[model samples]
Target: MRSEALQNWLNQFTSRSEILKNIRDLEKNNEELFEELLREGLTYEEVKSRYTDFSYYKGLKIPEGARALRAVEVYVGIMDFSDPSVMRLPGWHDGNTPSANLIDTSALFGALSKRIERPFLANKTIYSRSNCLIRYTGEALYQLDWDVLHALICFCRGQFNKRFEVRQIDILKMIGLSKAGYNYDLLKDSIVRLRKTDIYIESSSKSPAMSFSIGEVKSLPKGKRRRIDTFSLILEATILDNNVLALTLDARLKFLFGNNEYGLIDWEKRNKLKNNDIAKKIQCLISGQKTNMQRHRMEKLYQLMGLTSSFKEFTRLLKHACEVLLAAGVIKAYAIPAAPRGAGQDRIITIWTTEIPTPEELQAVGRVAAYACGE
Candidate 1:
């Protein structure tokens, strides 16, 4: 009787165990299928490598001018930063400048957030780099327009250096969004998850209103870094971006030379950069370093071994290299002038091109004229 009872219990457990096993197998299959769809056209390494770089993304596929909730939230953040109250502070620019009466976050938001009566309401304390956090209200969730958000981000970054990173949990309380005791941890969690899977979150410091290039700053005669006192940081940003993009174009265009018809083939793949001392010093100049040497001697070396020919090629490479650096956000665009002569014509030389530069290119030409003149 005891043996029969034990057999009946074992039979029941076996059936349940088989059902559990099936459930686990089904879950595994679903996961694999979902991953397959996600990686349909991407290679494993391509998909894996994207996450290595950091960026600022507004939301899922928020195309230009498309409306979305997160987009609106981001826009509001920009508006909050640009309010006259924030901008008009006497010492705001100095950061150490003090104000007799500082505006609190709630009052500032109350003043700014009115859509009709007051459209620029803000909520957190508006002091220093402490941000005016706009809580992600669920009410306007569907209508969060993204174009507005992008414009706002661009405006804020350009105007005030304000940038949005991953949302913080304490931000909800700071912005007065936790009144209902809602678990905003869930909201934070969702955004965090999106960041992990999406490739768009990476962001750069906002581009400047105008373009500039890496040539703005140059090394002086005595191994010292000279500041381009004339070029503003904002101008540098724009130049940097353009240089990078142009460089990418140049690099891709270089492949055209590979045609046997063009006679661009290299017999020795000439390593113009040898281990020679002079060569290494030249490398330093290209890499933004300074060294002391007699200009006459340097000029002599340029002619002695036909280094100028090499320099001509190097200049072409330098232009392309600058573009690459700008693309990588390493430097900005700057117009360098040609050497000057007493009682001689002071002509402008577009450093990266052979053609005469446009009027816009001439705006900052005077700054580098002396340096290029070798005076």
Candidate 2:
């Protein structure tokens, strides 16, 4: 198949004369007879001189970082920090996507529920914390599940309607997929979680209960090859189209992205670092928060980031993240506050705006969390 890059090259020289000339000059000496080349008047030249002739080049030929893929354009944008502002999407749930698998006990949300072992809370199945009530239902989604959701959210943001078309290659690229390559089974299970896991939100107002996804999948085997003569001529092989993957976003999600309640992430940077679990989770937690200034206990934070590690171990991972976040100024500094009485007893992490935080500000609520929590 012709890469999007190569197909673009073919489009540059629309004239047959230019195509034939480029082909012969670069064809590496094996120019055999063909009705097409004969029709175009080309010869089998075994040797060529390193001669230079000035030719007026056409417009930009998709240089290496043509980072202008359609989804990329929608999800990412260049920022002008002089007047700092972020892209906001309305009705974005901004849920605390705590990791299920990170803590061994957390995944118990599904298995424990199956055994009905609880003195059930709110709605016989609800879990509550300060000011929030969650009527949990179905198997809890893990970090991997959140991965799929985040990808879809990235796709759905700025889109008007709920429906969108995707190519398999596109999803792979967006997720910053590793060379280990696509895991078809994992993808199938993720779709099921999005479809089957149901939860009802009852914070500010009442709304409909919905399940994200439920295991149903239809395979779209690769489609028939596109018939582009110029493309075929370049590779001397057939080229196939990417398979289309169609999905519907939950209407609730429309509140997140469609309405402009989205967070701006430096995708270039995030994409580069996402393979590291600590790095990936921290970036999202920092950006996903609705408020500009957030202070959370290290323990709460560990839960929020979905880390199952002990205080000592999780902080080790978190310390690594602080290096990146601090250098980028995403976080001001960690403060293990000697708060009034018993407020925020655990180590506290105070986050700052995109701008660098002042030293005095860092010192005020400030005691190093590492020392407080035992580095």
Candidate 3:
């Protein structure tokens, strides 16, 4: 009988503060029952069992600051918030100096490749290199999608499963897009596409297959309705309002960064090469390698770039891209060896040791190395 009454009272309140206030009121009338309920119903074990993780805390009256900390705890499993490495990362901030952009090795291998004319819902194998196979479903993604995703990741500071807010104009500026009306529309489309795109990765290594999306957008509720006659006004107001976009990255992304399986691309150089998709893709591919010198077959490069041009044209484009990279100091030198007699494939070899690191880059590398060593 008492349990039934307690559940009825609990269901009447939606927020935590309301529940606490009612509980205090109950204590005033029934001290013995209140103490018993506090011990049995609100114990630490019961609370922990009910709210096992951050996701379970949503829609509750938890403070946003506390939510952020709890999100880190749930995803990272680090109890000590005092650790500097848990809150900060190299190349994650935007400043005067160039910072590194974090990208998963699987993505850097051309998962988000050239643009497709039509969006497809069925699973399609977009990129396959060596033992890595990447399949994607949903809207077609291109260089712009890649740029938007990178900027969003920077905004989140590499924290997955945490909500962050940003203005559309700020996103545009971060991606080197001008603040025009059409650009805002383009940004909105890109965000939607990112939310819809699903990626599945398969590798020949011992690790199992992984699947995830880039991020999800949060929708704001409409304002209260005034009257039927004022419907148009309300609609117009909603359309004209400049609302901040809220986004949460997937927690599974942390798996990609684990075991030093991620790569850091020079952010400034990427922005410079933004107009040239081929050059940016090549830059990512080269940056993902462990050694300074790398070689790839021309046939494989053609497929990896998702280019529809003829082999001859692709080789021409590849040469030009290398020249652009050389001018930008992204690569030391590149050579495309001609196919020998009756050879099935030619190779494009590149060396990137000539590029000098900025002070920020060195500091970032030092921090990563220290963290890896568990310092």
Candidate 4:
């Protein structure tokens, strides 16, 4: 089939409830693919080279850094920080040019503390201290849109993932730790623990994240006396910053790439949840009594965006909006190394929006999401 035609067919099939059920099943059985490869003596380097491309190679298109991805689609705007007397505040700028000294996280925390009427408890941790860069305290106020927040979280997730993995190894190596013994085991155990907490979900079907095992030489060669010299295991749950695209790729990769043949739940029969609704629900769940008022704003978001209909359709619309944004150069897309491993109807997506979208722009993106979902 022509690529365009095939895409259309996939899009249609993904919207159906029956197809979603099949996709979940397919994702479950797909884990065996990695297990099979390990059984056949394939090392982590071999599989990663063929799949994720973590190593540097001439003429290879490694995925862009997560922060760079965020910078590309980020929207900048000026803030009007006028005093009660209508006098302009210091550090105010005239246009969209963000100040060179951006307000660091601490200042922002101060601002938030002031706004929320809370005591400013200080911590020495980097996350607690915040970045020292200063731009404008006022302008930072406007960039807190859900899309923008989502992108920031995505960036944080990426940074956290890379730092935890690479930095730990670097630290171990710096301390003159033995490559063959103690350090290696510690790193391996840490990685397993991190994956369990961050990626794998603990439920009956065995989340695909935990389904694949590290290709340890000892584990790979069961009865052989090869002394278990080396091994590598590619973690299956790598999600980039492009939320919608990442989600789509994740769903497919989980279903098709591995040995699993189980499919996703049927949306029609099982009644798939709506994207906007889910977002609101999640927001509510995450919100404590302190953040309860924030829920009203999100509700306003739904109303202004006219996303009061089906949640399933809202996701489709969001995908279409992302394509439009990509075409408009407001966002970029990343191609995963492997096809998603799942069967059925749902389009799994992980989309990030700008931190500060004007009410108009917010409505526009919402409209785009609505349109794509065929709402």
lDDT value, candidate 2, whole model:
0.40
| Comparing 1 and 4 on TM-score, the stronger one | 4
In order, the Cα lDDT scores of the candidates are 0.24, 0.40, 0.51, 0.25
Model 3 segments more than 4 A misplaced:
1-121, 129-133, 207-240, 341-344, 353-375
Best model per TM-score: 3
Ten residues in a row with the worst lDDT in model 4? 75-84
Question: What are the TM-scores, per candidate, against the unseen true structure?
Answer: 0.15, 0.48, 0.58, 0.17
Tens-digit lDDT track of model 4 for 168-279: 3332333233456665564444333222221111111222221332112333357754322212112222333421111111121121112221112111211112222233
**Model 4 TM-score, 2 decimals:** 0.17
- lDDT, model 2, position 255: 21
A best-first ranking of the candidates according to their lDDT comes to: 3, 2, 4, 1
Ordered by TM-score, highest first, the candidates read 3, 2, 4, 1
**Which of 1 and 4 is ahead in lDDT?**
4
Task: Estimate the TM-score for candidate 3.
Answer: 0.58
Q: Report the C-alpha lDDT of model 2 over 1-375, residue by residue, as the tens digit.
A: 112443354466755456445554433342221111221111111100000111122653432112112111211122111211122233343332222111221221221112232332222223333333334334454445556565655554523224566565555566656434455455555666555544443222121111121112234447953221110000111113555556655433322221111344554455555445555556655665555456766666566544344566666666676666555444554434444445433667666645444557666665554421111
As for lDDT, the candidate ahead, 1 or 2, is 2
| lDDT of candidate 3 over 266-292, digit per residue (tens) | 666666765777777777666656665
Model 2 weakest lDDT span, ten residues long = 43-52
Q: Which one is best on lDDT?
A: 3
- Of 2 and 4, which scores higher on TM-score? 2
**Please, what are the lDDT tens digits per residue for candidate 1 over residues 179-213?**
34344543333233222221101111121101112
